[model samples]
Target: MTVHLQQEQQTMLWTLAMHAHDAASTRPILGDRYAADLLDRVDDPPRLGLSLAGNTPLICARAKLIDDAARAFLARHDEAVVLHLGCGLDSRLLRLDPGPGIRWFDVDQDPVIELRRELYGEREGATSVAASVTDPGWWAQVPDDVPRLVLAEGLLMYLDPEGVHTAVTHALTPGSTLVADTVAPWVTWIAGLQPAMRAADTGFLSSTNDLAAAAGAVNLEDELSLVDATATRTGGLTSTAIRLFALASGGRDAMVLRTYRRP
Candidate 1:
């Protein structure tokens, strides 16, 4: 039951990210089933069941990486707000115990939001908004006075360069910090090699050779880190597929984590 949306590719990645989280939670890597159930709510049960048998390890690894970052942010800030831009069915709010002080917003398309509502009962301190991240209106609901930690996992590659810029710029507040994961441009070419990947979505690979430049475009002071899932043996289907893709595409494109903050 694939639900096609304006950004279909991005949606698929979001689902994939959720699946990864589910794998991690159920298997005790992250030590909870909350995130897994959140993912289960939206996933095509039969299709995911088949994939899990073979890809659980990969999925768990990717989930752990994302969970680690989310956990770290919650740990450091008592009043932090987590804005999961393009958040599909991820239940990070359920997975991390935020001590009743943190707020979590899950933003995505209307249909996705509806699906989440139907599948998972809403919890306290967690809200879902149906809006594009590029739209400025969504910010009205977020408290501007407090610190915000924005997570854009597997999101930017499907947005045009300008759209990504606008989303980052509009989402940024004086105390905002952004945690994003993206691939290098060459990785995009490699991603196209897999037939399954090519069928997923619409958007340009707006990644740059210099992640700092991309972040700077949105007025964020960027600190970039490399993420080689292969080196860490934590590569998921997408990560492994991207690695094979890099070989096929004939380049050295790498995965990266770019953290943006205001200086």
Candidate 2:
């Protein structure tokens, strides 16, 4: 049986649908081949209009960038811990399939985690924690000793400023790496203007023009422009438009993927 999701939780389905759509395309960027199968199981999947469909490339590109960084981290560390905060129903654990030494944790709200469990049964090295990232107690469930890699893809903006700060500070242990994607302040405002977002009674709660200011104390290790990544992964007019937008000042930061390391 399928589970019911609240409006906010429905956002995960939209992203999953985007990944599934891209996988079926001729040249897929993210190449999450399992996305289509997962999405198909949903009782009523979200229908993507031009606006949402147009974002497929960017979303898939972001996923691809995160996957690459995650794979590299796993390669460098013999035994590691991965905290996928706001993991939703994405098949990241299955996609990466890290070896025995790695302990992977997929964290999310209680309801979302419930559905995820239904979709994905138990895996050897993976554990699903059903709790909010903002809750301090959830941190206790994760080990403090192991080297950590925190992934917060498409997660931070849904949180208010204080929540963002709390989650970040708690996630960054010594020698840990964090990879997250954030939209510019203007995009956050624009997201609020979307009719669909309003209808769903959900919208972006916070955004940061400068991630350094928002994350606090972490050293920025790398940054990738979603626009640039999308351009690189796509072709023809889509690539041209993305490249042109990137050329404009501050355009690359419009939606950025940032990698930070804790000292």
Return the TM-score for each candidate structure: 0.75, 0.96
lDDT of each: 0.63, 0.87
Q: Give the 10-residue window scoring lowest on summed lDDT in candidate 1.
A: 222-231
Instruction: For candidate 2, report its TM-score.
Output: 0.96
Can you write out model 2's per-residue Cα lDDT over 10-110, one digit (the tens) per residue?
Answer: 77888999999999989999889888888888887888877778889999999899999999999998799999999999998989999999999999999
Candidate 1 per-residue lDDT over residues 1-263, each given as its tens digit: 35444445344434554455544653334344554454444434334334333444334444556678778877888887888887776656666757677888889878878766876668898889999887888788898777888888667777777777778776666778787766677767765664444445443467754345556644544433333443344346655764564464423335556677753
Regions of model 2 farther than 4 Å from truth? none
Predictions: Cα RMSD each: 4.7, 1.3
- In model 1, the Cα lDDT at residue 218 comes to 49
Q: Compared to the true structure, candidate 1 yields what TM-score?
A: 0.75
- Residue 132: error of model 1 in Å? 0.4
